[model samples]
Target: MGSPKRGHHHDLYQIEASLKEILSLLSEVEIDHKVLFLNADAGFDSENLRQMLEKEKIISNIKTNLRNNKTAKNYYYFDEELYKRRFNIEKANAWLDSFKALFIR
Candidate 1:
């Protein structure tokens, strides 16, 4: 979900917009008895996103952004093991970058 951010805008804004589109697509598709999860960086952490994931029954593995409040206790559960697998997604994106011409068009 990472992309070039213009100016100082936060990633949460982009993710929020994308979520609507994603949920719409999900509604059009029929997924039966499958566990769904979302992996995102700390930059995308927010209570709003947490609520959205909760409502959709999607397991959220977003890292906590401790820059603002380092002493706050996170009530939300995070699975480090699953988050580690996010690198595989990054690798896939990196591989896709090699074919920039295909996407640019």
Candidate 2:
């Protein structure tokens, strides 16, 4: 429910670490579940992270830039209709940001 922290505008490694941490927490909680839907900005795209998720047999539905080289020959199974519906979550964030009090100076 929280976004990964970005310090000095360099957050690639931090985002990866946060994802790993979240996975570990989920495992510790003993939540037996399949199909993890992860939505992330393009910066979170990394081969190592993707391979880790694959090794763990966790399906990830992440948003990424089509032009990124990391997508080369990598087959991701996702429902386009479902993804379109999920776009509302992003829109909600934009709507919330309209209230300047939500921002911390």
Candidate 3:
């Protein structure tokens, strides 16, 4: 994680580097199966990131965040049912937030 700074840090800012790190760790762990999907929020929606995930054979289930360009949504595929499952991840994060001392440096 990056240092706590004065302003907000967008998730997409370091996504490529972070994804590389995660892929390396996954390789080390030897998961024995392919990573099929990457369920993320709108903050992670980007053409570059989608291409990277596609290269790894992982389908991105990120929400549409057009940011003013509505036509961009047509280029991506979003699964509403799969996206709903993302709430579980949020719940886990919320639980972790209760232990902020361990996570927030």
Candidate 4:
């Protein structure tokens, strides 16, 4: 019920917070990979986000929409295996939403 007010958010503001959260989680773990691949859904996809990823030298695996890409050449290179996991997570959230008893509010 606590959604952001309509015009207060843009893609970068939303994504920057998500990125920081991911980084905080990663800080508590030990991983082998030097090059990290960040997979974000279409909503988080923007030119600013792309530039941020490129400048950090992180692999950008973002889903695209009509507004983001005019041609195939401009699209982000997505990893099929990892990208598939994104949808799985979304599906899990959808399934969880069916339980009315869990939401106290």
Candidate number achieving the greatest lDDT relative to the actual structure: 3
Weakest 10 consecutive residues, lDDT, candidate 1? 26-35
Q: Over all chains combined, what TM-score does candidate 2 have?
A: 0.58
How many angstroms is residue 84 displaced in model 1 relative to the true structure, after the best TM-score fit? 1.3
What candidate 3 gets wrong by more than 4 Å, as runs, is 1-7, 97-105
Model 2 lDDT tens row, 1-105: 335564676446565566667777787889643566655555656667677777667665655657676546766665566667667988998799787665765
Instruction: State residue 21's C-alpha deviation in candidate 3, in Å.
Output: 0.2
TM-score of each prediction: 0.76, 0.58, 0.77, 0.55
Candidates ranked, most accurate by lDDT first = 3, 1, 4, 2
Worst 10 residues of 2 by lDDT: 32-41
List pairs with backbone clashes in candidate 1: none
TM-score, cand. 1 vs. native: 0.76
Candidate scoring better on lDDT of 1 and 3? 3
lDDT of each: 0.77, 0.64, 0.79, 0.69
RMSD of 1: 3.3
What local lDDT does model 2 show for residue 98?
80
Please give, for residues 12-104, the per-residue lDDT of candidate 1 as tens digits: 767766876777666667553125888888987888888888877888888889885487766668898888889998899889897997878
Q: Considering lDDT, which of the candidate structures 2 and 3 is the better prediction for this target? A: 3
TM-score: model 4 vs. ground truth: 0.55
lDDT of 3 by residue, 1-105 (tens): 333334678878777877777777777888522567889988887888988998888878998887834776456778999999899988998898889978777
- Candidate 1 regions exceeding 4 Å error are 1-8, 32-34, 102-105
